[model samples]
Target: MGSIEDRLRAVEDQLAIADLRGRYCHLLDGRQWPAFIDLFTEDGVFEGLSAVRGRAALTEFFAHRVPAMTEEFWHFCSNGTVVLEGDRASGRISMEYLSVMNGVSYVSAGHYDDEMVKRDGVWRFAARRLTFYFLAPLHEGWAGRPFHNPAA
Candidate 1:
């Protein structure tokens, strides 16, 4: 972070990390297993929908599931904030997931709490936890939010 080369490397790291995230969404949506498996660390964990560990397990998991998901689904991520920590970093990426379930369109807005590591000059996800703010039906919206607790 001091020398010019260091600064450039830092910027490069930032962009690479962002690119990694973009690839994550694209790979998932496109069902590109070979490329997608490379985006995670050997022991990466996904704590969204369910907890999955290791690149092998993740590959196996999505292989069976993704094909069965609705073709109309899309995953859009934005508002990413990444903090550099030498070989490790943490980030939050806001995202919206839209899919048709039972012929009804539903949208879920959330953020991913990410723990990333630079392994062998490549950035990969070590852990990602999806925290949803809301899930709403396209017809009703989130107006009568039932998952909230006004009394508490």
Candidate 2:
């Protein structure tokens, strides 16, 4: 919030961060584990039902868990808001997904609370925390049930 140059930089940064989220969805849904993990910092942490820290752990977690649970999947992200502060930024993104497990259809909705850092001109997630509102099989619906892991 300063000169024209500063304002331009802010817009650019926001767009880049948005791109990161887009790529995250594509990579993960596509099961491109290595590239997906690269979206994070080396010490990045992903907190969902459990916490997976560091790129190595993230790779392991996604590679094993996602495949084990989902036969097919698609991730949709929206309602993202980012606040830039020098080299660090924080944001929230709404997420929804359709998935298939053993020929059973499922749906999930959640939001990600993200802490991101700009490192060497690229923004990467330092931490991503997911809180799900619903994770239910398509037929059963989300009402009157507790949130549970899709994998279980």
Candidate 3:
């Protein structure tokens, strides 16, 4: 068994990671682009409907991609499961999203597969990949609809 300090450090790391996940939703929904990009490492990669590598490409990707999709949206992430290995970790988090697209309300369900690294005692995503089960208008629902990766 690990010592007391090790156990405590693990708890602290878990909490910090949880906070990171929450901050992602808030920053994305708030349209705080700069802060949002900061959540990832300098060479971080994001993959979903499309892919972007490094902070510079991420900046360009969001600046162009997000506004084109919708100006208003809410991103929610939950059910996070992480495996810590010293300063590195891997996790999967479930997400539900709502957005106003062309005046229509749409909902999306998905999960994020993340690889994270802790540098200088701070945790950041090294890579994040999203997979969507479905995305559809509120009136239509998800049944019989094709899955989507809506955003990168």
Model 1: residue 4 alpha-carbon error in angstroms: 1.2
How high is each candidate's TM-score?
0.88, 0.95, 0.94
RMSD in angstroms between candidate 3 and the native structure over all alpha carbons: 1.8
How do the residues 1-152 of candidate 1 rate in per-residue lDDT, one tens digit apiece? 29998898889999999999999999888888889888889899988666899987888777765555454568899999999989899999999988776677877788999999998999999998988777677787876564321112
| Candidate 1 residue runs with Cα over 4 Å from true position | 66-71, 144-152
| Error at 113, model 3, angstroms | 0.4
How many residue pairs clash in each candidate at the backbone level?
0, 0, 0
Candidate 2 C-alpha lDDT tens digits along 58-105:
988899876886789998999999999988999999999888988989
Best lDDT among the predictions, by candidate number: 2
Residue-wise C-alpha lDDT for candidate 3, range 42-101, written one tens digit per residue: 999999767899999998887678778786889889899999999999999999988887
**Candidate rank order under TM-score:** 2, 3, 1
Candidate 1: global Cα-lDDT?
Answer: 0.82
Find the 10 residues in a row with the least total lDDT in model 1: 143-152
- Candidate with the larger lDDT of 1 and 2: 2
TM-score-best of 1 and 2: 2
